[model samples]
Target chain A: MRIGELARRSGVSVRALRYYEEQSLLDADRTPGGQRDYPDGAVDRVQLIQQLYAAGLSSRTIVELLPCVSTGTATQSMFDRLLTERDRIGVRMDELAQAKAKLDRVIEQVLAAGLTRDGATGSAPVGS
Target chain B: MRIGELARRSGVSVRALRYYEEQSLLDADRTPGGQRDYPDGAVDRVQLIQQLYAAGLSSRTIVELLPCVSTGTATQSMFDRLLTERDRIGVRMDELAQAKAKLDRVIEQVLAAGLTRDGATGSAPVGS
Candidate 1:
């Protein structure tokens, strides 16, 4: 497999793939003629990297955790770190939920007002 | 209130407040020496802007929607847009949940494996 195919299959940009390689979170072999040759595993590897990144793991942390995660093994330190990361994700999820609820209230209020686009305000309920 | 005061109250950077001003998501009056003077309401306005931004609104969309949201009025278009934004946030939350679950599985696996830090693997149940 080549880098472009890996990027396409993983749904990540080639630039990001390169950065992953630089971070040691991903690896590819050099071909005899100086091109990058990725094994089939690279696709899954890139996707995993994305998942960890989305889970709020920094690149350095991902580098540290990848081997243990891939092998289904973890040191006590890694376990502790994973718990902390999980709590952080929970905090972020709560923030997003709060934002969503605020938007929902605004949306509901506007709907009750019965307004219209195109420079027109619909007749809202009259003194109800 | 001055710009710095607004930033302190809103918990956003002075630079971000300026950018919000540039995007018209925020406004302030000019003082005699050209310092920006924000009304007391500006604190709440900036916090609202932060919430909308967290809800994944572009600055332009925030600019368009702020008046209706603040006034508790909404055009039909804005209502539809808000629904879409809410849906997008839902999808993002689902993705975050999935990532957390994946990490949970990994953590559980490692715990069951009973690994330890300091280059030691803890003892696991023998043939259980």
Candidate 2:
């Protein structure tokens, strides 16, 4: 498939696909006319890349992990590093959960305050 | 205190402090020598800005939300927007959790394989 089709199928932008190629996270073959041609498996590859990126892995780390993921021949050091990264993600998730709780508290306060103001002024409730 | 002191107290870099000022997420008074001087409250304000940023709010949204956080005077639209942003963070948290789980599974498989390899080849266990 062409880059456009890959982007559409992968739900990633063409520019991002190009960037993945630049980062060596994805590969494409050149056609006789010098246009980029992707294999059928490119869609799944792109999705996996997106998943790793969403996991907060840097391009360098993703590049290292991709080969190991496919081959299952990673060195001990790679596994150790991956474990560290996983722990970091765990910490980030906890922080995000805390932040979300804080936001919920603030949202509750705002809604409660709005309700009181509306009651006092006889105004219609917000978003009504 | 000066910008340097604010940065030190906030544990944010000086360049980032200037960036917050540029983004209008922070403010500073100027000394006669034109150095940026921050009030005592600036530490708390910078911490708040950091919290909002960690919640994945953009600088623009932070600017909109800060006044409400401090003064409790947000409009209904702003409140609605904040709720939406909070929900977005919730979704992101779920995604990160799933990603972490996936990483955990892969890490387990890698470790199991390494153990098998060590047993077969009489190699020392990885990281031992």
Best model per DockQ: 1
The DockQ of each candidate is: 0.58, 0.38
Candidate 1 chain B superposition, TM-score = 0.83
**Model 1, C-alpha of B9: deviation from truth (Å):** 2.4
TM value for model 2: 0.82
Q: Per-residue lDDT of A69-104 in model 2, one digit per residue for the tens?
A: 765545656777778888988888887887778778
Model 2 Cα lDDT, one tens digit per residue, B57-106: 89998898786577554566777777888898888888888878877888
Mark the regions of model 2 whose C-alpha exceeds 4 Å error after superposition.
A115-128, B30-36, B115-128
| Error in Å for residue A4 of model 1 | 3.0
Instruction: Evaluate residue B109 in candidate 1 and report its C-alpha lDDT on the 0 to 100 scale.
Output: 85
Q: Runs in model 1 with CA error above 4 Å?
A: A120-128, B119-128
Candidate 1 local lDDT, residue A17? 90
Model 1 chain B weakest 10-residue run by lDDT: B119-128
Interface RMSD of 1: 2.5
Among residues 3 or more apart in sequence or in different chains, the pairs in candidate 2 whose N, CA or C atoms overlap within 3 Å are none
